[model samples]
Target chain A: MKATPARDQETVDKWEVQLRKGCLELAILAALWEGKLYGLEILRQLESDSDLIVSEGTVYPLLSRLKVLGLVKSEWVESEAGHPRKYYALTPAGKKRALEMAGIWTRFSSSMGKLLAPLGKGNK
Target chain B: MTMADDVQQRDAQQSMEAYLGRLRRRLRGMNDEDAREIVEELRSHIRDKAAASGQVTASGVDAALAALGSPEELASQYLTDDLLARAEVSRSPVRILESLFRWASLSVAGFLVLLGSMVGYFLGVVFILVAALKSFHPRTAGVWVLPNGADDFNISVRLGFGSAPLEGREVLGWWIMPIGLAAGCALVMLTTRFAIWCVRQYRKSRALPRG
Candidate 1:
């Protein structure tokens, strides 16, 4: 039976939602691990590197939560323009977690690759 | 400065101050230095926007305020993905339910204690016992009891050269029942909405590709 358009769209949305939910924490930690950044700078970097876009509303609460968990630390530094900017850097614990998440991603990708290898070879 | 110009400047400063006040309240519990920096940055932005408009009128101030949006909305834009993930983790339904249950239990217990003190020791003891039993088996006992029929209770009295009788005094009207039910339903709806909002925020933050 042919799937209706609405059903197909719903399936796609569900997969996208699952993928986003699964990777959000890893992405955030990885970004911070590279270097400390203020909110706007992080957004700019993300825009330059990938398709991901985040709003300040989502970022602030997340930062508060991570700070509570001791995964990240933040400080205020004077900007060249004389305004103070809050800069966030990864804590040691956060760095460790980032490494662990990266390992998991690598293993999962490899497993999926193995499962799809026969199909890839057949196509070749 | 002309009278009109003075008024315009005052309005602009007032609007900026009000917006900053709101942002500060929302940013409570952050490092003091960080909070101050955020305030300064926002202040600078408002000043720049106002200057760019070239006319410091009430309308220009309003325009700058509108551009900033509500404090909550602006603050959300500045949040990092890690913060969003943390918010999602804490917004669990189980956590909310646990908090609600605790609050309800405390309120009910306090009410019962106050009633018992005003009435009598025996009544208070009885209430405590009943509350304990109900709490242990909330599903079986229900949260509250309602009189099945109001018509059965009555009072009759004879005074000097007169007789009076009162009957079917409604302690709670039928309309009150629906109102209470609506209030309870609203509370549940609000809690669910908040949880959903937290989840959506988390997903949005996560979906943003990392640098």
Candidate 2:
């Protein structure tokens, strides 16, 4: 039926949202894993580097939560044009957590892939 | 600046103000420090976007706002992690009962330790009954009835039936009340420590990764 495609799309959209939510922190930590970036610059970097393009509102609140949990820290630094901007960088604990979580994700994803491989082959 | 440019800048500023106001209102439950930090970051983000686009106009402001998401969606993300964690813990009936037991024990233990007397024991028993009842029937708030004074503190309740009267009482002397209270205090402390350990183990199991 015509409703089937719409239902499928809705499910896919929900999955996409969940996937993004699950990995947003990982993406942010990965972005900051290299160096400190101002709030806007982090957004730009994420949009450029990956498929996980997110809104400014989304990133700021996440950053605030990370800061509250002591995983990230921010500082106001003068930009090239002389205005102050808040720059975020991972704390040592954040870096440790990121590595741990990434490792877990890698193993979990691999296991999922293996589990789904037979189904893919069957469809093929 | 030219009049047209001035108008454009005013439009941009007003849009930014409205966006920030929405954000502030949506984040009402958030603590002040975090709310202020988020608001400032958003403002700076808009300014940065505007500067990058080479002019501050209504369109540029709108673009920046769009990139940030609507205020409701944005605010919801801030609370999602905590809400998810709580939901995860509450998924199992075992966990819910565990939490209820923890609540009862901690309160009773606290009362026992703080007010080490017959009155404290009476109140603690009442509190535990109330908590257990509320857990089973969430809408009900259990009540306690006690006699007027500590000396007449008879831990008893009598309910009359059609043929026979049902009565419950702790038929112990007033002098023995203090000794019982002391023993209860010690038992509560020991049991609380053990309960906390068991709870931690349960939570650890719950938090374990699933295939």
Number of the predicted model whose lDDT against the real structure is largest: 2
Across B1-211, the per-residue lDDT of candidate 1 in tens digits comes to: 8998998889888988998898787655445775676687567555644665565566776776775567755543333322334445675444443333322232343233333322333333333333344434333321223234664433211111222123223232233334434544454455445544543543454433222
> lDDT per prediction?
0.56, 0.61
Q: Residue B170 of candidate 2: its Cα lDDT?
A: 26
lDDT (10s digit) by residue, model 2, range B1-211: 8999999999999999998898787666555786777778778888888768577678888987877677655654554432223334444333333333323333344233323333434444444444444434332233213454664644432111122213223232232234434554554444444443443333222211111
Error of 1 at B7 (Å): 14
> Which candidate gets the maximum TM-score versus the true structure?
2
Window of ten residues with lowest summed lDDT in model 1 chain A: A52-61
Docking class for candidate 1: incorrect
Model 2, residue B154: distance off in Å is 22
TM-score of each: 0.49, 0.59
DockQ of each: 0.19, 0.21
